[model samples]
Target: MSVKSIVAIVVSLIILVAGVSSVYVVDEREQAIVVKFGEPKRTVTTPGLHFKIPVMEQVIFLEKRILSLDVPPQEVLASDQRRILVDSFARYRIADPLKRYQAARTEVGAARLLEDAMESTVRQVLAKEPMNEIVSGQRAELMKKISDLTNQRALTFGLEVVDVRLKRVDLPRENSEAIFRRMETERQREAAEKRASGQRDAVKIRAAADRQVAEILAEAERQSQTIRGEADGQAVKIFADAYGRDEDFFEFYRTMQAYRKSLGKDDTRLVLSPDSEFFKLFMDNK
Candidate 1:
């Protein structure tokens, strides 16, 4: 090849390289800023082919997509003076490319600043509420406050805060253990009190039952004694009438009853003279 042909070919390649470097494309998911000599010149949000001065102007592409950031868990103090472990996250987007580039050189840098803002905002907002509120249904309100504050702060970095969420909010391990133990102790105490009350009620019921049984038995015995006394009186009247009708027969009948009573048992024995009055009736019969 000729030397002139080689020189012309080299110049054409250099021109092509410079032209390609001067033009850059921005896509739907990207926003860009053109910086000349380390100074941002213009911000471009429209997605299309763009131009810049080769070797002097540089295009910094910033993501237009919603970015997610997970913040580290932090121990924060609640208004109730309770310590809580809170882990959170947020979604954001680059609203102004030029401001974003000027404020943070890279996405990583922006994320760091946003994370700090998120932590500070969350802590401040939570500090105004008690732990119960933060852990309960009212937590949604507190999170909104944090999100608003974070959005306001994020505006300075040309970032739009979309949403801030609490991934997990709970008591520290030590606090959790202490609370659980206390709850268990309280339940146990309540159970013991209930058992004692039941025992007292049972004792009262048993005593009442025993008293009722004793009254019933005493009344029954009184009725039985009354009936027996009435029978004895009736028997004595009949005996008097019989004795008036036939004194000798009645005397024999009474003596026979006495003999039966005396010898009712097989072991019966008596020491008496054959002519004794106790045996007079028996000797006459014999």
Candidate 2:
């Protein structure tokens, strides 16, 4: 080969290598940290083709996506000296790539730092709360406090904590069993009381109803007797008035009825004058 041609080929090869090394593409969901010899140079937030000094600088890409870290369950003692198992989780985002690279340098390292800070914050906050507050209604407030404290500490490491939440707060197995037994006992007692109260109420209502029924029947019987007595009196007065209009006929009829009622087949003998008043009826009939 000619000397001029050899020189042109070598320059072309060097130019190709340098061109290949100078350009990099940052993805849409990623941020790049430019480091020169173990020292951060600049951070690139925009996503596009970027330029760097060939072979002299390095580009470190970090995910800008939201992240979730599930903290393992830990036993915490509350202010009431109650031991509880607390399982929590957190959400975070990488806000500053350069700061994140300097502090943690990897996602795993950042997660570990977050876990440590969360553990401390949880312990410090929960240690002041009562067991009931930790397990029941005050969980949201406590989680907010933990998130605020963790975020304040994590700012230096370029992590923005969005929220912290507790998955569960459980008592130990033995304590849980005891609580359940107590709850069951209380429920049974309440149920028994309710049943007894219902029975008493039913008995009272039934007795009242029975008394009312008896009073009604008694009133009905009294009214019936009064009506029957009034009817009998009115009938007797009517019969007396009717019989007064025909005294002679009434006397004759009464005499005949009395004879018929007193006479019997077994009475064979009698002593009486033929013209006596007692024989008047028989003589008239003959």
**For candidate 1, what is the TM-score?**
0.86
Deviation (Å) of 235 in candidate 2:
4.8
- Give lDDT per model, in order: 0.92, 0.91
Candidate 2 residue lDDT tens string, 1-286 = 9999999999999999999899999999999999998799999989999999998999999988889999999988999999998999999999888788989978999899989999999999999999988888678899999999999988889999999999989998888999899999999999999999999999999999999999999999999999999999998897688679998887787788877776655775668777988768667564
Candidate achieving the largest lDDT: 1
- Candidate 1 lDDT tens digits, 158-261: 88899989999999999999999999999999999999999999999999999999999999999999999999999999999999999999999989999999
Q: Would you give me the overall lDDT of model 2?
A: 0.91
Off by over 4 Å in 1: 238-252, 276-286
TM per candidate: 0.86, 0.67
